[model samples]
Target: MKKFSYFLAVMFLFTAFAPAAMASAPEKSNKEDKELTPEQEERLEEIKSRVDEIKSMDFSSMSKAEIKDVKKELRGINKETKAMGQGVYLSVGAIIIILLILILLT
Candidate 1:
């Protein structure tokens, strides 16, 4: 139990400090600051409109299949949005595994 607590403590510290460390890295040129191009920006606006339409929908009146289709569409839009963004995104599971590896190595 004590060892588990220590592991959690280390993991918490790592998760808290990791973002700070990454943020402190030297900035690049202004080009790197621009996340998306004009075409991508237009597409993003379309996506936002579609999402808003979905939100304004009456889901309760829809059939199960229709609901399923809406969910699938949302998932596709989510993937596309993520693909359009530029960054190294780490999932929670990946972060935990990385922290474990660092802990074991130390």
Candidate 2:
């Protein structure tokens, strides 16, 4: 009976600590924040601000050509953001898949 009780306590401790251990594991980079060089960070911020500016503009009052130009700039920003995310996204996806497999197997 004593041995069984000790085993139960050990199991309870293991279960409690399992999630903390997983949470503390080094996370896969899911964004370009830490990866960006100083110049790239400045450029990204500039592009983000430009995108916000475009969004806040009075599109209804703009001329057709101006709207088209803004649309082009928006598309360019989308491409740049996608490029920045490419590396981080794959790793994150892989981590998720591995976790799912572990869950299912256990």
Candidate 3:
């Protein structure tokens, strides 16, 4: 019957396209932080080295004002790390918003 043939065609198309859709998606990692890009790894290493260098210094010889300045510098480094990650989040957000607007307009 024509109805049976039409049903088969629809089922065949669905099965064929389903795997293609799934294949295009990337697999998510359980621990995203476990993977780091080269630049991120480099930054992490620099921060670690800076902390080690600061730890090796003799605080007894430095004046109180000098230690306060060092603490402020460490806080600044922490802020830099936070700022670096936020740019990616902001761009992704902007893209999603743009997509929603386009979808609604259509």
Candidate 4:
């Protein structure tokens, strides 16, 4: 009886852990891009703010290099914003389509 009770307890423990060990995480969508690290995100925000400040300045009398630098900063901000914007667009589009399908089905 002692040996049989130990076997049952060990069996219960293994069963409880087995499924979790074998289960897989769901895969991300192909439309999704790699996310930036926390540090990268903060830097990106800083870059955007700097670009906005530069744009708000009057550039009429600026030299070629100054205009070029401002343009470069603006492009960098646009690229980062576009990349971040893509994920949001995909998510909102998916939600809207799902809602439309549900409306049609009902």
lDDT of 2: 0.73
TM-score ranking from best candidate downward: 1, 2, 3, 4
Per-residue alpha-carbon lDDT of candidate 2 for residues 1-106, written as tens digits (9 for 90 to 100): 7985786577566667767887889978646354877788798889878878877899899899999988888887888877766322444345545765786699
Off by over 4 Å in 1: 1-11, 20-32, 86-106
- TM-score of every model? 0.57, 0.48, 0.42, 0.39
Order candidates by lDDT, high to low: 1, 2, 3, 4
Question: TM-score of model 4 relative to the true fold?
Answer: 0.39
Cα deviation at 51, candidate 2, in Å, is: 1.2
Candidate 4 Cα misplacement greater than 4 A, ranges: 1-36, 83-106
- Model 3 agreement with the true structure over 37-106: per-residue lDDT tens digits: 7998798789878978988989999999999998998888778766555222344335545765786699
lDDT score, candidate 4, position 51: 67
List clashing residue pairs in candidate 2. Answer: none
What's the CA error at residue 69 for candidate 2, in Å? Answer: 0.9
Off by over 4 Å in 3: 1-34, 82-106
- Residue 30 CA displacement from its true place in model 1, Å: 11
Candidate 1 has a TM-score of 0.57
User: Candidate 1 vs candidate 3: which has greater lDDT?
Assistant: 1
Candidate 2 residues lying further than 4 Å off, grouped into runs, are 1-34, 86-106
Cα displacement (Å) at residue 39, model 2: 0.9
Error of 2 at 4 (Å): 53
Model 1 lDDT-worst window of ten: 85-94
